[model samples]
Target: MDKTAGEYHFTRLETVVFGAGKVESLGRELSRRGSNRALIVTGKTLGRSKLLDKVKSAAGSALAGVFTGAEQHVPSHTVNELVAEARRVGADSMVSFGGGSPIDTVKNAAWQLMGGRAGSRTIDFSAGAAESGRGGDILHIAIPTTLSAGEFTPGGGVTNESTKVKGGVADPRLQAKVVILDPALTIETPAWLWASTGMRALDHAVEGSYSTRHQLVTDTLATKAIELLNAHLLPSLQMHGDDELEHRMRCQLAAWLSIFGMSNTRGGISHALGHQIGPMWNVPHGVTSCITLPHVMRFMAEVAADRFGPIAQGFDLRFDPRSPRSSAVECADRIAKFIGKFEVPTRLRDVGVPREEISRIAGTVLEEVKRANTVGVEVTLEQLVGILDAAY
Candidate 1:
């Protein structure tokens, strides 16, 4: 194997506060950002949790209002509604209080409200949009309570209700101004959600490692992320002993590392399919990964076997060193076992996705992949359907 130093750029939130109780620093962080009016965006469940109250107490009078209307897939209408809420509250800054949904909602809504672009839902990442001027100037503080790493990336997925297809947008401004990773805030997250989103983070690392633009640095982070998630996710889900917080924090760190250099690369078919299936079938991104990642890994194994070596090692899957394809298959097998251990649906049928919808999902994915050209592998309608068929 030939090795050469490759170039890649790393971008991240302006500030990141990571610890057990760093959520308490929200007010001071907001003040430091010169934000006086903050609107909290979250889902209904978290809205009612004492977690929101903790954020409220931290924000004090600086908290202008709260909007708990965030939903799965971030429907465009929701973004429009949240924009109205932001306007009504005169919120100078926003805090995303849930997982990917709320964080995505805040980024898209803020982008539109702050005069970036309306109807910019279909993110053409192939055009290098992340390096362009398309997002807003709105200040966003992301306090993620789940393992979804939406806060770390500028890409936001928004669903069109009428079409039931999710599109994405990428711009640097959509990246949160600050991100607070406090494991305490995640204590109330449902076990299934924590486990599923842990899969989502695992997907990020797996996909990032084999991304067409994968860099040495990003690959290193992605590999370590896989190790951390594989080691800690189950224990975190089991929530054993006083060290459970440490497990959660490590998972959070894994989530961050999973996408650390994603700005320079993009996830392959699993994510592409997830972006479309998420809105079409109303499945969460993590669930999409549960149904798709292993299948996609198998599909890509023929062409990208070498790329799976680190992931195989991360999972401690022993394979014949002479056959990279066998190693890749072992990697996929390990992922399936890991996902199954959580007792989550690892098949489309298990998730209630109609078998008939496979073609439609493939068609949609084909169009998006053709248009964006961001998928790492050469994808065709047949290949997409084949992947879906295997998942089914």
Candidate 2:
């Protein structure tokens, strides 16, 4: 099918709630999704926080057990542990609490329960019709505290502890059945982390907008997502009072909308670079976007310049379709300036990737480009290194 003429399939995601204290309705929401027993999956810090208590209280009789073992990057071993725990507790559903890591950890667990294996490259995120029935009965609920919006997507990447390499699974049925976007829970997030993740969401909007598989449905959603994130992210970073809660809510909504197009689009240049460099260097996913997104935009502009019009327009910049390449570069500059205002690291070196390792990292990224159908760009090792060097 042509870009404008492609089909869109609704994911298995069924219910969502958004507000300050909407988490208090977790039990009711669980009922809405036809779930009763839930296993809470989260990291250590939040495992000890009052938010956990709040969620547990809200879960009440529905809570089966808690797994506080979620680590960054959804380590493969953790996925196993979570799987064993979910089975032991007889959990019919999983609740993901925290940012992308724990959310993805739960996704991996659901994937496993539904017969997916960690580190299995043979399993596509959109495993087609024959395998479509696998995860349909396995439910997951997400209560996100950061903007790394893994909860909304069916894909979840897991890293090998020994090799620091990443692999992932995606099946539409594995997407969270219910998502509760509680800005009240997000007030505890560290500012830099929140800001960096907002950039990650922005990356989603920008990437989806210019995707080669771009569709009218996704373009419209991506446009609104970009506009919402562009308007609210910076202000949401420094929450001061009740009014800021609404900004944070907008951010949460935008995060949900940003990756709405992923199912229909190929992974972009930014994602290919970020996917490798992130786990390889222990850089957080959000920080990877801060460093690589603008450079990837500029690099991809050669053939896809006109596709950037929505991105520039999202940033409230003037877009001249007559001068598409220049407009694309201008959009890149504006994105960089927006990222700079967050005071997060804007270079690979700043994020602790050694200067001497650029070539090695580039080789790894090229392999990722080959592995995923990313952006349709024939990226060479030299071009990859050039992008890294520029970011460095």
What are the C-alpha RMSDs, in order, of all predicted structures? Answer: 1.9, 2.1
Candidate 2: which pairs clash?
125-170
Give candidate 2 regions above 4 Å deviation. 1-4, 121-124, 128-136, 371-374
Compose the digit string of candidate 2's lDDT tens values, residues 237-353. Answer: 665788789999999999888887776764677887777777788898899999999998988788688898778778777888888998898889888888888879999878888
> What lDDT tens digits, residue by residue, belong to model 1 across residues 1-392?
77786767545478889988899899999998889999999999998898899999988779999999999999888889999999998999999999999999998897787576656546455433345554337899999999989899877888878888777666776789899999988998888889889999999889887777787788888889999999999998776655899999999999999988777767678888898877888788888899999998888787778777668767877655578898898798889988999967788888788988778867767766666454555677888888889999
* Number of clashes recorded per candidate: 1, 1
lDDT, candidates in the order shown: 0.84, 0.82
- What lDDT would candidate 2 get against the real structure? 0.82
Model 1 off-target regions past 4 Å? 1-5, 126-136, 318-322, 371-377
TM-score of 1: 0.95
